[model samples]
Target chain A: MKQKNKKVNYSKWGYIFILPFFLTFFIFSFIPLVDTIRYSFFQYFRSGLKWIGPNFVGLENYKSLLQSDMLRYAGNTFILWIIGFVPQIVISLLLASWFVDARLKIKGQQFFKVVIYMPNLIMASAFAMLFFALFSLKGPINSILISWGVITETTPIDFMGTALGTRSLVGVMNFLMWFGNTTIMLMAAIMGISPDIFEASEIDGCNSFQRFFRITLPLIRPILAYTLITSIIGGLQMFDVPQILTNGAGSPNRTSYTLIMFLNDHLKSKNYGMAGALSVYLFVVSGILCYITYKITNDDDPDGSKAAARKRKKMERRMK
Target chain B: MESKGYNRFRVIFAHVLLIILSFLCLFFFYILIVNATRPHAEIQKGFSILPGGYLVTNFKNMISDGTYPIVSGVINSIIVAGCSAALCTYFSALTAYGLYAYDFKLKKVAFTFIMAILVMPTQVTAMGFLRLITKMNMDDTLFPLIIPSIASPAVFYFMYSYLQSSLPLSLVEAARIDGSREFRTFNQIVLPIMKPAMAVQAIFTFVGSWNNYFVPALVLETKSKMTVPVIIALLRGADYMNRDMGKMYMMIATAILPIIVVYLFLSKYIIAGVALGGVKG
Candidate 1:
């Protein structure tokens, strides 16, 4: 009886303690989410200020997104994602491996680490401004190229003016914005590998490259997968860089336009219904991509006695 | 013996490569700093590696022009960031502690809710949130800016994981046996022990709040209430294309100074916090 009373008292306190978060989450997060779904189906106008009726536009918004020029925007986003995500992971892994290798006693390791990570702290707007100044046609980059006689004096290369050039510029922005964070995460993964494995590999006469490929990469494969999946989701949701760099116009004939920017444009145009549809589309696409990535990586642990037994056998063999 | 020589070469090559990458990073920083100091003509003349002497003049112009409020925006940013961080950290700790210490049927459900919410990007529900705020007449106030952040799903998840891994259940059991109420126990015991996680979360929350632009841009219409990112973006639009390069660079420099200063001082915590947040996410 006393224990039951204690349990009741504890449960009541738990409710009280968690009330603030639950209340705030419902008001701020969950309700809005429900409303977003509801608004996506209705036709909203600027003057109505009311959500009209229960107009069921079941698949119309999705159809429009599929047929609209927004598909081009999605393709551009994927291009940026490929350019950014692939190199980011590769370069970050290389850096991480180099930092951890026992053979290389690089100077100012900590300083370099801190410096690389500094950009991550700056607001995206500020980072965009810095890059804008650097990449402007009359900016230092072009001037330097001209002074060095690398290019003819007549034609100045416009970094943000061309389609491919603008895409690559956005790629550079993506690289700079995220590489530091990746390096840091990759570094943690590298550090987590037990020294025993490295020692054993050394005893077996594995060189740095060999060891990295055979041991380190496989060991950190999980972290790499995690980074890749997250970066993909983040890349798909790319907005701020293009938003600020292109001054929210998506620049150079919307070549730098992302799905989020497209959504924002719809919202600004007071087409909340279409905007909601676009957001839901993005959400679904991201979800599907995340699922595909997980499947490709095979990161999920399988259930059932057979799978568990197979895992135990493998562990025993590895232990030997 | 040949392999040893090759290994030495490889080490040299790696260092050289890393050095180049580091230089690239520093080069960008140099560009920002130099641009902050140089005259508009020099800035437009392409990249100037050297700092010019117009920094003071630029600063005076930027401040006096009212395009960027160095003083007011910083104060406003501090208030918003500080309040959000405190509330977020406190509530996250509370929820995490509640979930950690208690055994209830809702435990699994609550944890799943937090994780599910984590996957929903802010943009997905932003329209709904805006509408709700407009109806509540909280559209123009800082309440919209600071309130939603208080229940950050990411922070809650972080606190939950930290509580699970680092905190021992014995501590909670002992406090409960001593007849302490749950809230008091958490306040007196659990919180003091969770200082490292709290410190890390506080800095992360503060930085995120400070650097936030989109939500604030959509919500706060007034200039005075604008955070640093919004103010800086607006200043860029008004000053940069308008040929007020002096004010533009000045605003940019002043806007970035707080983050740079904070980062320079608390880089270790910030890096750790970022790593933790990344891993949790």
Candidate 2:
């Protein structure tokens, strides 16, 4: 804590307070992040007890990384997000707007909130495994599809076998898992918007949709940007869904293999150099996205920080 | 202008749409629970809408299966999740209080560094970190799982934001004026005030650690040492248990019960949190 009256430097306490976090981060997170970059440059092999080499390969690993399916894997991951988050955002926004609209007396709001958000509480891998069994050829889904004459009993469709099938299944899971959280977040944003804005828009003869697009959307842009960027970053780290759904195979010709899955494959196969390169690739891509998010959201912050600085300034002004 | 009848129709339509969506949201869980109670052969006969009488049988089978060691998996999960949640929350809050309460030169840089780590994909650092753990001979131990969570950027960010909104610096200054030690003040005074934030973060961290299969799958070599998700994976692969799909569904249900219970007990706080919203923001 600070004292306005005490002028001598007491920042040592600040350093002490924050030491555990930094020390732990230094050992576990920062070092590994640096190691990922460092390990990317060297070629290595397993040889008995002693490792054969982490000899300087320079950009050799990077060069070969370009030739891999990583770019495609990244694309597939984006496609999955597009499929998943589009419906997610649309539904969440709609639900949120309705709840925010007072005229729409949506009863049982609390119940629906709990029910919808329930799925997010469980492990993604557990859900994936549940779906894996549920969609098996002899399982309930295929049996029903056959009964409904959607497909023949003779050749049951392999839901996890084809690329599109696998992607769609994962997409559906993602959509289901996320939409509620998105709804809650959007609702929160709407709640934060002053009620007067909505009333003014209504008085100006703006319809519900117009008010939503012109007023609510514009004001909540920061939140929207935050969600989108985080989702993009999270989409890149999609591992548990595809990994478990395909039983670690990344099947259907690895179409469901995300960037993490691809790197995990490298990790599993002990191709340390190649895995390191992929890790760096992922880090760079995510860093760029984070930077873009930072720039977009902090455009108005003269200090080049976010709202925290502004809030602190306000606090300081209040104290004065 | 639209007629009153048309407005009524529109409102009704929206309600129906939401109702259907909620049902769809809950449908999978319904099936999973139902399937858990159905006999393995009955499960093969395609989807049935209601519960069957096989839950006890499935539970017994799970317990009796010498190969799976599911009880140990549950215990292991509780230990890992519980420890990680406590360490992550207390230390994160302590660190956040550090930044929030104090004035320091490198404060901004430290804050930025934490934010960077927030978005920095764990997959990027996972390999090197794993190697370090193995080198330290910490592989296959819960220490590796529980220890690193103290540096959780996401949790730190949450605590930082919570402290920003809730904790007034005047209180800290008052405590200091009374000659309360810095760490003691944090532990006794600030921590009690941070209960709601801690509870929310604790549930999140606990569920996340409990559900985490990736790192555990990598480090744990022995079956006895594995968590529930990994053991579920084992059961799925075991050809003998393949016939016991009911057991599989039952196991999944059992694994998630603690999470569901926590959710039920603390969902009001969580909904409040949902409204407050998000580590990234």
Candidate 3:
């Protein structure tokens, strides 16, 4: 009996420890997510001061969302994401490779990292406000451009007033905010490669360009894929920057309007059904995009488990 | 091997590129700081790279402005962000320690369950969350903002990895032999050992909750209840009368000041934390 008492199974402790996290997650996130899906099927909304039906509407909300400007908002999201991401990934890769290159012997790498990452710490809302103030007709950018004679005072560029200008600013802001983070992550990925591998590749007469493309890029593919998937999900949820920058209007013909902004518009109007459907659409679209990115990045790996399995199957077939 | 000349050229080229990028990173912030010190008329006149004398004046104007509750906004932001960060780090660590310290029948399922939702964006559940909060009468209050941080999947993932590398099962076994209760062992022994990871994650969680705009904007309709970001949005969205750029810049500067100060002190840990999270993520 003493021995049995001494041999306590500690597994229940694990459950007890993790209970609060699971309980909170289920209550706060998972249940709401499931409910969001349920709400999408109902015709719940408010008309003026009157609460309307949560009556079963089946797919009516989804049908209406599809017929509306949902696709355009999605396109805006994708375009904004692509523009920001291209520059971000490119610059990050360049900076990451350089910083990680021991031969470069870069000084003050920490300072550079800290400085670059500072923008990311600022609130997106505040960042948007800063950009708005700076790009206003009377703001600093125009003032400088005027002083430089790039544009006359009378014709100062209306940056937030045009679709291209607004999109470009949003893109630029996103790039600035994220590139540092991407750089840091990529640097860590690069550093995880053994020095012996690089030495061996050097012995094989691989140039820097060749080494990066043939070794570093392929080795870091998993992290890259992870980065891309997260970025896509984050992009799909893009809101505060564009929302605040455009004054919640998505103005200039609503070309800069994002899916979340559209959802926000519906929510503001107390249209729960439409908002729920839009949320579902966002979830589905991000899921598909993440799946595609994962497949594309993983399937082509020469040394991956899937490839190995394929090779093993071929070998078995030959033996048979 | 690459020639000495080629290596020198590459080094110089890399330095030049890094310098230019670093300059670009700091330029806007520099502009923001410089503009924050000047009065509205001065800011509207033109951009200045130099500091001005009206910093105190602008700050006073922003804090004392009757239309916007900037002071309450700051306090509300602190309350929400502070509570969220503490709960997020503590609960995430507890969850990670559970998976780390013990074996259970559903251990693998539990680990995978948390990880599978790692990429789930909060936006996807906004409507539902809003509905939940409203139904619970949680809107216009900070409860919803602070309470849901208990299950941050990303933080839990980081903590789990940190524990795997830093902690040994022998420590727990030794504690059990010494008659330390499981919960007490975690609190007294494990928590202290996890101080570094907790600090790093706490800073990140704090900043994240501080900058969170969407959920708060959706939930908090009352001016006094709004966080700093929400208040900044309101200030920006206000009519032309309140669109004082200097005061706005001051407010924005004040909003970002805490994060900037924290970053200045703990940037080394924060960068390392990102790198750590990134590798396993």
Candidate 4:
């Protein structure tokens, strides 16, 4: 009885240990999240020194946002993410396969890995600034291009002036910043696969492309899915790079504008109602994306899925 | 014989591609560094592959300029990131240990809750967080930025998995038999065992906090309280365009130098940690 009592005492220590985390999380994160939702349904803003209404409204904030450029900004985000992610995934897969190919005996593997990943260490804001300096009207890139006669000194390319140019610059920067990390992750995933499987595939006369598509690609699907989901969430919250690059103006006609930048503008204007509504929108969208990815990627058990399908069919028959 | 030749050709092709890609990766950084050393007039003239002699001059110019509080920004960034790394690692470990060490009534519930919130992006809660900070009068302070480190779900997840693999419950039982207190056992025994995990997570958390711009930009109104990223943003403002280009580049260089230095020393661990984190997830 005493021994059991001591064990129970230890259980209370579990609560004690976790108490600080929960307390802080509840006060700082949980309450704020709830309050955000509360504010979303209200009319709240500050006009100069005077306080505006905290008056309750329906989904009026969300309704107005739909009428705004929110959908266009969302489209811009999707386009930017796609442009960056396509090249990123392709290059990462190529690099990972090459690095992991034991037969290749790639020299200085460690050196290559270290060099590639250095960009991920640097601050994104600093990175944006570097790009901004490099791609300015008389920036190094333009001057160099002119000197090399790639383009005449008469017409320097305005890299940040057009919609396509800005989006492409943004995409290229995202690709550079992330490809290294993605390559490293993919290499790890490929390495986790058993060597015997590769040996068997080679013995069966599988070419490099065949082996990758049939064996490596399918095996690493989970990691790929994980990467995609995280990248989607990250892309949705993309503000720092474009924000710094365009100096918060979203440039050339607001073509480079993003959803978070819009939300930030609302917050900057002290329009809490709109900002709160946007936050709730982002929350719901990300939650749905997370659920979809989780469901899609978690189909690791064929028999379990088959059983589920059978159960659904049985229910359908009974209903009939 | 044909296939053997084909394989050799493939190997050579792959090496060539890799070399080019690696060069592309480092080329912009090379340009940034080289330009940082050049005079503003020389920079305006054109790009140069060679390093210039004005590195110290650029540094001096950046310091003498009174536009932004560069010194205070660096100091504030260090304090916030350092405190965040420490609090995040210690509290995450403690939280993970609690879940791992005991089987209580709400154990599964708590575990699931943390995991569910793991994917909850901070951006989604920014509006509410801002409102909360204002109402609590914690605006313009480092407390909002640092205090939220206590409840980092991703770090908690990583630590929990690390404990599962590295720590044994039998050791806890043995320590208990020796009459060591619960907290002491955790601090003395578990923490040391978790040193590698903590170190890796510390680097990541520190870099994340340092690179963070959004939260700091919102919360910190005082120039003295602003972080490196925020200051760098201010330096990139339209008014600074007519300013000295060399100094601007130098400031940008300074902003990223600490992280670059840290990465150079700990590249192996940071790279390994990233792979490990992804795999575990």
List the candidate 2 regions with Cα displacement exceeding 4 Å: A1-9, A47-52, A146-152, A296-320, B1-3, B236-241, B278-281
lDDT of 2 by residue, A1-320 (tens): 33468675657888998899899888987787888889899997564556656899899999988897778888888887788889988988899888777877888888888878877888887888888887887877888788889989888988877889988999999988888888888888878888898788777887766787999888777788888988888898888888888876667887777888888777876677888898898888888987876665446663346788878999999999
Error of 4 at B124 (Å): 1.4
On the 0 to 100 scale, the lDDT of residue B135 in model 3 is 89
DockQ metric for all predictions: 0.53, 0.58, 0.67, 0.65
For model 3 the local lDDT of residue B275 reads 91
B180-278 in candidate 2: lDDT tens per residue? Answer: 888889999999999998998898899889999778887787988999888877755563335678988888888776688779788888877777764
Q: In model 4 chain B, where is the ten-residue run with the lowest total lDDT?
A: B235-244
Docking class of 1: medium
| Candidate 1 chain B: 10-residue stretch with minimal lDDT | B238-247
Error of 4 at A288 (Å): 1.8
What TM-scores do the predictions have?
0.91, 0.92, 0.95, 0.95
Per-residue lDDT of candidate 3, residues B1-281 (tens digit): 68889989999998888888889878878888998899888887788879899999988888899778889999998999899999999999999999989888889889877766777778888888888888898888999999999999889988988899989988988998999999999999999999999999999999999999988888998887889998888877884323577788888888887799889898898999889877863
- Ranked by TM-score, the better of candidates 1 and 3 is 3
Alpha carbon lDDT at B137, candidate 2:
96
**Which residue pairs in candidate 1 collide?**
A139-B46, A140-B46, A140-B47
